[model samples]
Target: MMTIKNSPASQPMLSMTGFAATESRFTGGLLLIELRAVNHRYLELNVKIDDNLRQFEAQVRELLQSRLGRGKVECRINLKSDAAVANLTLNPEMVGQIAQTLAALQQHFPQAQPVNLVEVLKLPGVCQTESIDTEAMAQSLLNGLSQAIDELIAARQREGEKLKQVLLDRLQGVREQISIVKPLLPALISQYQDKLTTKLREAMQAEDDRVRQEIVLYAQRIDVDEELARLNAHIVEMDRILTAGGTMGKKLDFLMQEMNREANTLGSKSVAIETTQVSMQLKVLIEQMREQIQNIE
Candidate 1:
């Protein structure tokens, strides 16, 4: 089981896709497996095989589905050489065709290579012979395919690791912005209160009591304390999932959206410039994570 801690890039990147395969052989046995994959909305697969190997399609599909979660994949199997030929094959049809053609050419060019049985047999399609041991080929292909599939999985895991690091870095950035905005909250509330008081003083020059009541009601309606608390809670959930490991892509994606929602709400409340900046930074980090989650399996 490969994990996200193995990529070299150390960043959240969602564009990687890879493929690999291998094979092995045994007595009267042949197997070739090819694996292909790419990022997509969900895990999808298509398995293709030569007409003779149609029986193996289900087996290959099951093998892939059990291990992968979120990519479009294709698998194919075929015999690289004809097994029916056994040790030697001769094409009578080709021999006849070539012999006649060569005789016609000799009429015009006397010096042309004379028609010869050995030469005709050596030509393409004239003789199909092999020392190929089908058992050995099959076993070798099965072993090769197993290795290739493992290679493909490794490639995907390496890419996933990079994505995880990138997300962590972005999360740290969001935390820093949150810290910058956190201390400003008390001062921000006081400043808004002061501005309200000033406005009330000018508007109610004739009557001060009426203006004070309006200012208090305005402050309560615009409060963003609840939104900030939820934002913090979402961040905790994200960290927990990352640390626990395993298939958490879908869960992480949902949490990212929730984080963005909180940020949006905080921004709309608009208590101060620092808070607004923090909200924007949170959204940016969430967006980056969302893109990378699509590639996780």
Candidate 2:
């Protein structure tokens, strides 16, 4: 089954490969979001964010799906507290708790080594960073993601333009190959009839009617006009799809298969070395275009 990779109708063809990263500062921390996309049959998303920001993963996925139509996308988010605002301050409550616990311990073992103030301060929860506002952080995260996605789509657009040119050149090559073979058909048939007539004359001096019938059969077997016509039609459709420029990956792929089938038929009916060469050239061009189309979205 073929899968269509959809892109915006108003936009040019897009390649499903790009990379973008954005960083922004919020109330208490800085947020960094990075997005990378590669070709895929469908839109697949993998989002990785800090444990504290896991709550926003669903939101990130939704945002990406809204902006992108197709690709395997990987998103990474990192949030770090600002050095100036995040300075660790002593926890007065924790300190008081520690003092009360120490006094209780001393009552039982008064002779034990006195608790070191430096060591006590090093204990967990003894120091804490300023709390961040979740709402503000979420806003910052979304904003950064939006920017990164914009950059990624722009990169894909540039890559898509290059791919479009490559496909166009391959299509032109296919036309050239078809041109080379069309003129050879009549001459090839004539040569075949002459060779058959010569053989028949040497063997038994066959009647003219019999020889003509044999020539007609040979011509019918090797005729490739139908194949050529189909090939031309497929080429025209491909060109139209490329020009229209939206969700064409699957359509172009299907056309490539059809063109390849016709080329195979042309090769099988080859009456001359020139026709065989043309068939091979056509296959090569079609394969090249198919390879490029795989990356299109």
Best by lDDT: 2
Off by over 4 Å in 2: 1-10, 92-126
Cα lDDT tens digits, model 2, 64-170, are 99999889999999988888888789999999999999999999998999888899878999999888888999999999999999999999989999999999999
| Model 1 TM | 0.71
Error of 1 at 261 (Å): 0.8
Task: For candidate 2, give the lDDT.
Answer: 0.91
**C-alpha lDDT of residue 225 in model 1:** 68
TM-scores for the candidates:
0.71, 0.87
lDDT of each: 0.70, 0.91
lDDT (Cα, tens digit) per residue for candidate 1, span 140-236:
6545556766787788777777877887888888778667766776676678767777876787663546655665676665677687788778878
lDDT of 1 at 116: 64
Task: Mark the 10 consecutive residues where model 2 has the least summed lDDT.
Answer: 6-15
Models, CA RMSD each: 7.8, 6.0
